[model samples]
Target: MCSHIFNERNRSFSGREVIMINTDAEGIVVDRPNRFLCIVNITKPVTMESEMVHVHDPGRLEDILYPGNRVLLKRAAEGKRKTKWDLIAGDIMGEWVLVNSSWHRKISEWVIQNKIIPFLNGIDTVIPEKKFGDSRLDFLLMEKEKSIWVEVKGCTLARGSVALFPDAPTIRGRRHLEELIKARNEGHEAVVLILVFRQEAESFSANKVIDPDFALTFSKAIDAGVKVFPLCFSYEENTIHFRSLLPVFQKS
Candidate 1:
């Protein structure tokens, strides 16, 4: 199991300027004047696009960073270009912080250490590298005893008693449902786990209007023996705990 700790630092953000930093626990500065920087809380874990650090202004990057905040860089892979920069963690003005990668790492570690390992009952297994499958599979879990493939999708967009997925149309998401059906046919226990990070959602369902194909595939997968589990996350200051499993509403 992997673990992470947060370290606070300060820096300057001049609007669109980007800074590069080492992504380790004890964050280190790598470069300056790159693209964009946004404040993040290192104590909390985040994943996917939610981990981005937004630049508020072009000339104020240097004036708004501070300790206790995580930073994100834009154009992280490519070299410096207009309005692009490597994310360097720092404290710029006051109280303004950037999002850090610690949240995602911590959540991943928790899943392995507390959920997956224990559920497998001492069986040895490997965490497969995450990839963009027919849709996008969050994880591919494998073991000698029983083959288990899981797709993890985050449900952050919710309103009142209703919880929705794929706020936007996702062809890739539709493909993932198809893959789940394929995995089930191959005799593996294929499951879809929707991680609802927020506390408001009480139930979950696929948005038919956004992508009807996804809804159809999901219904077929369920009928074909693929288990769908939507679990809620209980959030504390810096830690996230899995709560009781929620029910999935399959309406086609």
Candidate 2:
């Protein structure tokens, strides 16, 4: 049952515990020049100077990525890329919320590989970024003769007791939902995995006020037999811990 997955910070798969992510450094937010770049003051490992860091996630992040907030960083090898560090998570209300989209694929793979969600237990192989009907879905899971088309979405916005996705309006998100419905109609199992990084969220829903089209499409996809999983996790002490499987609610 899914109830056992809600009991612990880390679970063992055949006696092997999973550490989803690890960071080599910490930083304080100096400024955000754009959606993909942030000026950070490296506070750990003897680097007191300001440097340009890569922000992987494309959300507006207006609520969390503000100046003076403490954040976690994953350092890149010297001279490997334009930015030396990548913004991993941000401190929000004394809790760390994973904001990096680069880690979304890895997190989704871990959940599927470990069979944390009972319905997805037997997924054998995860193929990512496959083009189907002009939409590049995040993953295509294969198990025996079963083909599952999956789209992964990272959600960081939490309000009161609910978690809403697409902190900004996303035409692309709406398109993904439409494609998932198409996949379902084509005799394939389709799923949308909403990874809610906020631990306090008791339920998940599509943000209708921000983008009503996406919200309506989400309900449409639900009616088309496409499954949605709003899995919650907490980022604390530099490790991601499973919190719970949130109930999906259509916000009216």
Candidate 3:
């Protein structure tokens, strides 16, 4: 298996070693009245003062999005929609954790294209949003005549060195695992690629406390030959640095 991917750079100028996704305006979060909208005090990059920013992550980010927390925002296009900015990342425990779902595809594609993962090093082509049965997975990797179906999940909740997914209950996430099991049954290599945005996360596991059903289905999928890779990353100053591959939690 591949160990940690690090180079000769600190956490700030870090991701020049990896993918450098950009973010513009900075803000201090005020409140999240609903799931998709957050009121923030835009402090930099043409300060707009108070504004409604679109939140892309669905996870319950009480720890990061609380009042007065620093965040990164990407300004929406001129006259694009109602919301002027998008919440991209938040400062959590001294690390910038990427909470944006929009970057998941770019990060995953970069990792795949660069042949970072050992098992996926042989991938020749990557097809996005491919349909498999009734489900549309994130990517379909083609290597020779073999097919590999992948579903990507962005994880933001972590405690100490352990990372847990779906800070809130997710029936849809459970269904995704079921579809992965079905793909495995059909003799296709199925995988759930978890992007752990928490920089300190050394391992990943299902949030059984939040959604027991998802945790149960997660185990079932693993038992049914679905591979899971909980990879660690950190978002720092408009760039994302690949950290390491975390293992699944196995209870004794």
For each candidate in the order shown, give its overall lDDT on alpha carbons: 0.50, 0.83, 0.83
In the order shown, the candidates' Cα RMSDs to the true structure are 13.5, 4.6, 4.7
Off by over 4 Å in 3: 1-16, 45-47
The 10-residue segment of model 2 with minimum total lDDT is 1-10
Report model 2's TM-score to 2 decimal places: 0.88
* Best-performing candidate as measured by TM-score: 3
Q: What is the per-residue lDDT of model 3 for residues 95-174, given as tens digits with 9 covering 90 to 100?
A: 78888898899888877887656778899889999988887889999999989999999999988888998899998899
Model 2: per-residue lDDT, tens digit, 15-120? Answer: 2333557797888888999999999888887676688889999898987888888888888767858898888899888899999988888788888887777778
Q: Write the per-residue lDDT of candidate 1 for residues 189-248, one digit (tens) a residue.
A: 776766654455566777676667777877798888877666555443223455545667
Estimated TM-score for each candidate: 0.56, 0.88, 0.90
